[model samples]
Target: MSKQPPLDKFERDVLDESVPIQQLLRLVIVLGGRAFSEPLRLWARNELQGYPGPGIPLPTYRMITAPLQMDSHSRFSQGRNETISALALPDVAHDLVSEQLPVTFSVGKLQNLISHQDPHTPLKLGLPGSAELARLMTSERSGQGVVVERIYWSVHASALHDILEQVRNRLLEFVAELRATMEPGESEPTVGQVHQAAQTINITVGDHSPVHVIAPHRHSATVSFPTRPHHRWWPRR
Candidate 1:
């Protein structure tokens, strides 16, 4: 068997849970820049600094789906704000409910949120077009005096932790590939070697190719809730 290269130490570091993910990401950015791999560098940069804006493709792992909730008041539940499903809005307003919420936060931001959050309380993110949805839903039942206060997604902390774990796993995979590509006694990988290894990995390259994920078959729990009557027509926003 050939002696492991010094760069192999990175594999051990990647496997260490105590090592901050941001630290590994910074190292990746440095390695990517040294290797002249734009894709690798860009990916690491985005993870550290966050994606520029909307319309940019995000990694499949960064997309998470959470239950939508809304705080509102109706004649039936007068005076008190009732928390109900944002999905309970009229069928016309259903288009506003995003099934998959893209997590564009930087790795460091996510880490900070997870660290300070209480395990029992979920982090709430304001849903886009929430105001519009509230207006539409309120107008649809104007006679009923329904007032929509807030619309947001209740995201579990574990989900954010999962994203960090996935990032670590990807780094581990890349380092392993780098190790395999290194020649005996070589301390570091060449630019060609780095590029070749990156091409084999799905997310390392900037290509927006679809990542096929096989979801485990798990039985979903049935949730019963009171919902408003469906409207045949959608009110124009």
Candidate 2:
């Protein structure tokens, strides 16, 4: 008979970047499967470095961690419309009463498992100033003046080719078909018009919860409590 899967370890940064969404549910399945089939008692023991607790059960524990920033933009919605705040990733699902999981969800493994998923694109991650239009923020300007900001982001250059190739095959065709239906006198979109467009192939996922996860896909629980803050969201001015 095939044996049950073992539990596995997961890292935050890698998983969040590469696989945080409901669509990429494979990540959670693979890791959780590994956790079930692998031996992870020592690793769980080590996670409790600060406070010594009896080793956390590999299958019974869960950890959900996510940090997000909210922004308002006019161009974000369908129209050049109202400014709205959307969660980069939603929060963990909760029961209104005990503030716990529904009785049906596995409670023992819930906290021990660490999963993070988002409905939108992953927040831009990289060297601070390079990705952000404005690097400096003064608390002195907190309540008052306006600031127009832009943060540029990108997927890995090497990987871009494959995804772009898919886009070329799919979305490009759709656009061409649509253009043909336009009025005979209509002009084609200019270079700038086409260049400014967003992706047609988007990976949809679960709620906005901060957890790096979709419903079934849980991100890795592996962590590196590095001595330095790799990237602090809002560093002290």
Q: Write the per-residue lDDT of candidate 1 for residues 72-188, one digit (tens) a residue.
A: 787688432334564676676566455577788999999999999997888888765567667877787688887877777888899999989988888877777767876676665
Query: Candidate 2 lDDT, tens digit per residue, 1-237?
Result: 863222112222223444322222233233223333121212222222211222322211222122222232233332221222222111210111111111111211221222231323332322233223232321222354423243223222222223223323323332443244434544332222222211221212123222121121221222211111223334333
Work out how many backbone clashes candidate 1 has. Answer: 0
TM-score of 1: 0.76
Per-prediction TM-score? 0.76, 0.16
| Predicted structure with the largest TM-score when compared to the true one | 1
Error of 1 at 223 (Å): 55
Off by over 4 Å in 2: 1-125, 129-156, 179-232
User: Tell me, what's the RMSD of every candidate?
Assistant: 13.0, 23.2
Q: In candidate 2, where is summed lDDT lowest over 10 consecutive residues?
A: 93-102
